[model samples]
Target: MEHEEEEDRLSNLPKIILHNILSRLPKKDGARTSVLSKAWEETWYTFPILYFSDGLFVGTFPQPWEGFLRKRKNFIDYVKRTLLRFYDNGLAIKQFKLSVNNFELHYMSKDVDHWLKLASECGVELLELCLPDGPDQDEEGRGECYVLPNGVIEVKSLTELVLMGGIRVDTAFMNHSIKFFSLKVLSLWAVLSRDEHAIEHLISCCPLIEHITLKCCSVLIPNVATNFLLESDTSGVMKSLNMHGLLKLKTVDVQGIQEVYIDAPCLEKFCYCPGDFDAPFKIDFDRCQNLKYLDLLSLKSSIITDKWFLELFSKFPFLESLKLNNCRMFERINISSVQLKVLELSNCSNLKEVNIDAPNLLSCVFYGGGGSEPIISFLRSSSQLEVDLQIPIDYLDLCNLRESLQNIKPQNVLSSLSLFIFQPTEDALNPLVFQVSSPPPSIKHLHLRSVPKNEILFSSVVNIILSSCCPATISLSFNPFFCTKAFIEFLYETLMERKEDGCFCGSGDTRCWWHGLKDVKVTSSMKIDENVDFKTMLELLGFGEEISFTLEV
Candidate 1:
């Protein structure tokens, strides 16, 4: 019997549906669909959004300098032709993104200006340009950069503008009469401006901006004392960002800024990372009562004290997530937030005690460094709370590790524990010893990562970890420089070969945790290999960066 022919329902779908499908696909894949049929070719032309990158046009293999230049030229021509097609057809471009790397700004400045003019004429709503500095960029970053044209700023239809890398906002920007009146989002990364007023003018023009990100953006101030200075003293970097009445702003992320004054009442998230740690840092959120997420990094102990945290929680009552990194806190601080769900603390060395009373918290992650361990106490937390602790283990200091682990309250559920083992100094020939006073807490998974110099050190480290923690599953990740084959063999021999006789506690104690082990399985990329010898498996699977061993006790 003959089967009925399948209908081409995909191609026959509505244009809007086809456009949606194409939007979900990568730019190259979406453009390739035009070759499928004439109907698709028409749909591709009217797609309304164009994204082009010089990197996408380059081949995977390294090409000669001449070939590279030819490919770059072709990419530029292709972008121009694509934009021209939309302009000629009078179709509104919803979004236009162009990313150029390794291209000299002077060589392509005119072409970039032309492209912007075309996009403006096409009524582009969202415009993104990522033009990284050329190889000739000086250390001071006052080198040649693509000066944003006045035409782009005058585009009243623009709703979102993202300019990254070696772009400059000159003094002309401040004098421009037209502004981005309809813009809702503005992101400037590594963007250079003539002065602080230029940046302030650019932002103040965007009255409807809801989100703003300024990362590593600088202010270039030409040195007047040319005889005394060798080069332009580009030291006038952006020190402060003050947003007075951005009522629509919801998110603000400013890095490399010493001070930030935000008065956005509707702001929901704010992240700030100071440019200089030694410089005096100041931040004031006047009326941001609707904030939900706050992230601060590299703050001094004096800036973030117990009183500061009290004022923070009192000001932003709706904060849900708080992340503090490399910040020095007071000796003891209380984080009493009822709405907090996620809390992350990293390298807060000065914190001796932390009391959290967030009953709605769902997860808390702590990353430790060489500083003294902070005793974290949770007065009230959700029953479903999961705590993740990443602690570094100095081979010479086993007692410190034990003390750090013991500092964690027994009531807190440690879902995952990651131990970063630091190699001992070469002169330290003494064998390290670890004593387990009581049974280790039940951890769902234990991740051990280290770059041991030899197999003997790796074996000793593994034994010490197993003795300290009774984890259901243990994951091992090694550096590629080490011989993974030897490590795997040692692990297999220790966990499987000597399972019945060996005790990880070093002392001959039969009551060890692994004595009741029923089965041991190896998992690679989530696939379990049962009853397999490590030597043979290593030969079959070759060397991988990570390997997991599951213990059935």
Candidate 2:
């Protein structure tokens, strides 16, 4: 009888341990465990997380109109029954995740509201609700918006709230309502606000919110300025999203916003993507002393002048990483920030000159194409630098290109140099081929892509570059039509010729350059009618054994 009692004790785990085990299992699997014995029946009911997703009940009905409706109804009934069982058992729910893809919100609005209230009463800490498109969709099927009810926002026990779908926030519920004292993270996707104040009031209530992500949201009005947008401007016109009082907030990611006023002193990271239509954004950093990472993209109208740029760096003295994309404001950019480590500038059409004086910099990338070449200079030698040139075919001139290449100073630390040249049929390569000078000796990787007719020019360019830099790896991206076995053989012959011409290591050692080439990658997915296997061809040519071939089809 003592042995039997010990076995029973082992089978009957403590309530806390049993609840934890069941909570980690899928809802259905955990519930099915109740069939094992009466001892396990109550364990499933007390499971903290109740995740009811319609996807779990897929294929329950036939693929037809009636079947679709039946499945949605069954999902609703299952969730209702599950929540009711928890209530009947007097169990508390700590987390809840609900996803309904097909249910009509107008018919099930009452049920959703009741479920939220039940979850709140059960002390739910994490709530995730994904509803279908809006109840009142337009005739074009373009609008899929859902309005969130008050019970979800008023849940004081919620620590993390993620509301997706075209949900509209009812600001009226925020006034005189209970604050979310415990809420720390809020994520809203395609959420529409009734007015700007509604969002402001909602944010004021969540004083503990640390991370906020607003993607494809509209009608965010600022309290400091009356320049507000109407609810009808669904074209993603965001006036302002002020971060004034939430001192504990750390990271904010916002897209499709026009203007943002940030005053949070403790903010560490910020990502902003401005829309097509935007006013000049105003950002004051009197309090944001802890700001570190910033990414700004799609700056169409809001140009950053030299003075404004200096002021920005001064305000955020501790910023570490900065990225600017498609911003066409400053013709000349000069930055001298000590704390900056990584800097990237891309697609700045009007930018002509860039001078950086960051001592702690580690990585820098510049993308300039189809315009007058920009002059880039680094005051201090830090580490890796990548220069990518995508000059247009119409503007392909050897003199201008040579001048642009000469403008970049102190090229001893460049790691990768990539050039994409597009030459028209009428353009002659003789001028550019001879003018193409050698690259920096420190470059370790070189990539070249050009039109098939300009193969000789590219070959000459590559030879010049390899003669100077002698990179260990070379990658060639080409149309399959031109990248035949003969073309690769020609490249091999060129490298051999360079080896014989005393171009290897300046010591006249033939084994230094060609033998040192370690990797050759050819990326071409297009099917070539010509039958050519790169591996067999390279082997037949007696390329060194140490060379590895990467032929991606």
Highest lDDT, which number?
1
Tens digits of per-residue lDDT, candidate 1, 1-553, equal 1221122566778988999999999878998999887778889998988888877777765669898788879988999999999999898899999988755566788899999999999999999999974223455554457788877888988999999976888787665577678999999998887677678778888879999999888877665766332223454558888887787999999988878888988999999888664678788884899999999888874677888888888988899999999987788998898889999999987778888888999999999876667888888888989988898767766546656766777534677888776667777645565664555566788876653555557655666677767778877664554435566667766788555444654444446677767777786652436566555556555444567888888
lDDT of 1: 0.78
TM-score of each: 0.88, 0.69
Model 2 clashes, total count: 3
* Model 2 C-alpha lDDT per residue in residues 94-154, reported as the tens digit of each score: 8899887765565666778788878888788999888764434444543455557777767
Worst 10 residues of 1 by lDDT: 1-10
lDDT agreement with native, every candidate: 0.78, 0.66
Question: What residue pairs are clashing in model 1?
Answer: none
TM-score for model 2? 0.69
